[model samples]
Target: MKQFISALMDAHLPAPDGLQDGMAHTAGRRFDVYRNNVVHSLITALKVGFPTVTRLLGPENMNRVAGAFLRAHPPTDPRMMYYGAAFPAFLESHKQLDQMGYLADVARLELAIRQAYHAGDAPAMPSEHLAEIPPEALLQTKVHLAPAVQVIRSDWPVLDIWNDAQTAQSKAQDVLITRPAFDPIPQALPPGGATWILALMQGAKLGDALDAATTEAPQFDMGGPLTLLLLGGALVSLE
Candidate 1:
């Protein structure tokens, strides 16, 4: 019975032959309507989930792209909230969007923001806690980051494109996504900021993370990243 119902939902089979009742006769049509509604709703949810991506692509283009995406990748999970996990990868492979090289990265950034918002919460370690750590141990220590912190790095100016689309007055910018409370917020980052934040989020010691950042971006500023992490609740605890 479950397999039959699944087939009906997927429009794989016709209604079981010859049912006398009018309601039973309409079952196929009803199922088709229901299926359409489900797809529509999921597509709408995807739009909401990746507003920045949608804004970058524009409405009509996004809708068409999303429709193609829906056909290529059907939802496997019951949870609709995380349905678009493959969207960035899908965008990357799409032939039409090849001209816009940064679209895939932008989609990734948008997806990361959604994940961060839904991530489990943990109280951040107080700034004083870092001070209490012995100087010698600081370099070897591993720190935990808040569940809401996510760092994304892309060669294209994805952060700048996102900011330009989102705000009227802001100049082109690179960004770090963080959720200090419940909502994810975008923070403009310095040249090597993403690499630095990625290390911190991965539990690297402060010094090691800084060194990684500097290696990648010689102009990376320690003060800026430190201040951003501390204020944004990215630092959870030091061990």
Candidate 2:
């Protein structure tokens, strides 16, 4: 069964030897149709999973890329939504897509959004919880972010490139993804924002994360990213 299924997925492979339709010798036309349908379904799933990649490559080019990706990385999980986790890395290594270095980052953003959408739900910590902390205690506090929160740091203006698609306005940008309500939203992060959020995500104390952010970005400010995270309900708890 595995060998037959594998052959079905690979166009180069001939229909499994002795494969037949209703005991008749393998029907080339029927086999071709079945193969095409399976390929088409996989491509369609890729298109839906990576809409930004599809928009960037267009339908025809995306189909080609999807076909190659499908062959190289077949779905291992039953859930089709989780199938394209490696596509961003695939794009990075693809020779044909060398010109679009930013495409991989864009795909990563989309993948993060999809993962956020499907993430397990958890109750958000009250925004006032931060206000309740004393200034001295705040430094020692370790924050917990919601499971759906994701930060993507890119050398290229990934969020801008994603939003505009045609013209990228900046050279570099960081993105913060959060699912505050029913849908997930990806917002462009201000300078030092991703650094700070990522540090916090790793279970660093506030003081440590702040120091890391300041070191990473000399002009780092805690206000903006803090507000964004609070408003997005991304803070789940603090220890």
Among all candidates shown, the one with the greatest TM-score: 2
| Among all candidates shown, the one with the greatest lDDT | 2
Candidate 1 has an lDDT of 0.78
Which 10 residues in a row give candidate 1 its minimum summed lDDT? 165-174
TM-scores of the models, in the order given: 0.82, 0.94
Tens digit of per-residue lDDT, candidate 2, span 96-186: 8999999999999999999999988878898888999999899899998899999998999999878875677678989999899869899
Clashes of 1: 1
Which residue segments of model 2 deviate by more than 4 Å?
A: 21-25, 165-167
Q: Alpha carbon lDDT of residue 19, candidate 2?
A: 62
Clashes (N, CA, C under 3 Å) per candidate: 1, 0
Cα distance off (Å), candidate 1, residue 150: 0.5
In candidate 2, residue 219 scores what lDDT? Answer: 90
* Per-residue accuracy of model 1 over 1-239 as CA lDDT, tens digit each: 55544553455666544523465554656556656676677779789988988987998998888877876787899887788999999999999899988888888888888898899988878899978888888778777878887777677767767766444334334577778888888777887787777787776777898899899889888789778878888888777
